[model samples]
Target: MNDLALRGDNIVKRFGAVTALDGVSFTLGQGEILGILGDNGAGKSTLVKILTGFHQQTSGTLSVHGEETLLKSVDHARALGIECVYQDLALANSLSIYHNMFLNREIVRRGPARVFRLVDHKQMRERAAHLLEDIGVHVPSVDLPVERLSGGQRQAIAVARAVHSNAKILLLDEPLAAMGAREAALIIDLIMRLKEKGGLSIIMIMHNYAQTLDIADRIMLMQRGRVTYEQQSANTSVAELMDIVRREYRAMRATTAQ
Candidate 1:
């Protein structure tokens, strides 16, 4: 398999007359976490959408696992081992922890058709319990629905699901947004664990530069629908990154101040 999990070249997107993304290009390496930094409306979400197959690029190309493949939809992204954990983790509140973890990809007994094929609930529960333990998630029980679990636990389950799927490239949009300090730390620790132990490559979108700098191997900054700066975490300082963000913010404000 190719170590370069995702590569976007001069990606462009537009909504009617408004251009959301303009010539965005980047590559994500295996087990490397790349932070995407940009203010609101800087085409962060748009770029993510294009990568995840939620939206097609107006121009340029996207590749998965070194092959130039078109992502027609979210399912296509998943098929390419590109799993995304959106900030709003769409875990079903009514489903059990195991159910939520497996979701549509439930383990089932082999049969001729769908007449007597049974869901392996016991196996799934055992797996879910093991996964939670492996990920250091302290959930009360796998039998409980996700609605009853705390926010941190819910997020952990979401992350655990990604691990179970053996995702090659993980896209996390604002993972720590709206999280308390403790919860945020827990999630960050999980991210680190995934990177170190599972060798999962991740693209984390976060406004908290300090936290991102601590975790990411590299950071890419986007401004006005374009990538303005890119730096390795070892070669860059938080102060320098902040300066870039501030400069972009000021430039944007000045543009709109007119």
Candidate 2:
């Protein structure tokens, strides 16, 4: 097997007296999709936060390209070629597509020899257009404000930004949560294309088993802040996954019935 682009070993995180994650571990290989399935409060969000460096792991090792290092913050993770497209997307509603695409790292032209010092709107816009096109995004134009784009277009923009950054590891937190079926389909296809064409390593948190199974190379089931099971998508059926969920739920209900 190819080496994992990212790996988390025995990760732990806590909030006050609550242990949100306990010894969670996983590996994400390049050009592969790993789907995380869990109900609310199952540590799915916590895991993503820790992975993206939004929240520090209380203990454990996070290795990127087989090198273990401390990811102090989101900037550190980004510097290591990791970017997360959160559920809310964090897009700038008031900004143009190009501006939002290069929000922080603006390209600047310092007078004499085109020294990079200013927001290179020209170059950014060109790159943004090409990125969208390469991802098969059918946006009307790259210069328009993001507010003018459709929901699917906005999602495509978010994903394109992540891809354009040369992010080796992509963490997506329920990108399809509020989207309609059609829009979700488009986003899903875009994700698959990212893995197939862009060779991105992806970790997606999703509740929709069927959708997860459709594109994921592996599915990991999390319960009560712990991963209880994992299965290869090709070797497991949705019905089986549903049964696992149902069984776990029933067991929880039964325990609480006392």
Name the weakest run of 10 consecutive residues (lDDT summed) in model 1: 109-118
Runs off by more than 4 Å, candidate 1: 111-114, 256-258
TM-score of every model versus the real structure: 0.93, 0.94
Question: TM-score of model 1 relative to the true fold?
Answer: 0.93
Which pairs clash in the backbone of model 2? 107-118, 107-119, 107-120, 108-117, 108-118
C-alpha lDDT of residue 83 in model 1:
84
Per-residue alpha-carbon lDDT of model 2 for 28-63, expressed as tens digits?
877779999999999999988887888999898988
Per-candidate local distance difference test = 0.87, 0.87
lDDT of 1 by residue, 35-62 (tens): 9988888999888888888999999998
Runs of candidate 2 with Cα error greater than 4 angstroms are 110-117
